[model samples]
Target: MGSQSEVMHCYEQIAPLTERMLVLARAKQWGELPRLEGQCSSMVERLKDIEPLSTLDEAQSARKYVLLGRISANSSEIVGMIMPQLSKLVGVMKSLDRQRSLHKAYGQPDDAYLP
Candidate 1:
């Protein structure tokens, strides 16, 4: 929980994180996405605890809109790039699981021949 000013400052922080997320996705750093996502979730939760901001001037309001738009665009692009890879990874994992199950049912040792 923080003051209104601090919450507004968080909005500023979110834009850069969104940019970093975009960069990470572009670089295929799938392992890092969850960490950044956790950070984003924390910030959003902080923002949620506070009341809506009503003191922003026109210029600040416009800037907020632009930053939010950028964040949205970055998120969309990241999802687009990651979804296919995620699908493929899931398929591979499912195949491995099926193979393991079949091996268990056959009760064959690791090096045993199976017909």
Candidate 2:
């Protein structure tokens, strides 16, 4: 087991947050995401400010790589969960635009439009 090195600590703090983000994403718990994302972003900034993990020993480097991989996997999963909803939202917006264009082009009754 590696000691509490700065690089290791940073990864430790981030990995669980990534896991939690994945969980929240899966649950569609959007209201909680912004706060958690902010915390993760802050940790990422701190990690970026610190020296790279290349200075760590072999074990620590391996651990860092694993943590980064998990974070990447979790993020990818989160994107997968979000993409479908985003696509649906875009489709609805396009449909609304089409309706607005039709309303403008024709002298149809305003009530004819679907809300």
Candidate number with greatest lDDT = 2
lDDT (tens digit, per residue) of candidate 2 on 4-111:
376688789889998999999999997888888899898888777674533787898899899999999998998899899889999999988888788878877656
Please provide the root mean square deviation of candidate 1 (C-alpha atoms, Å): 3.9
In terms of lDDT, model 2 sits at: 0.83
Tell me the number of clashing residue pairs for each predicted model.
Answer: 0, 0
Q: Model 1 Cα displacement at 110 (Å)?
A: 8.6
* lDDT score for residue 101 of model 2: 81
Regions more than 4 Å wrong, model 1: 51-55, 109-115
List residue ranges in candidate 2 displaced over 4 A.
1-4, 95-115
Tens-digit lDDT track of model 1 for 3-113? 656666778888889899999999998899899988988888877776375366677678878878988998899889999999999999998777778887889664454
Worst 10 residues of 2 by lDDT: 1-10
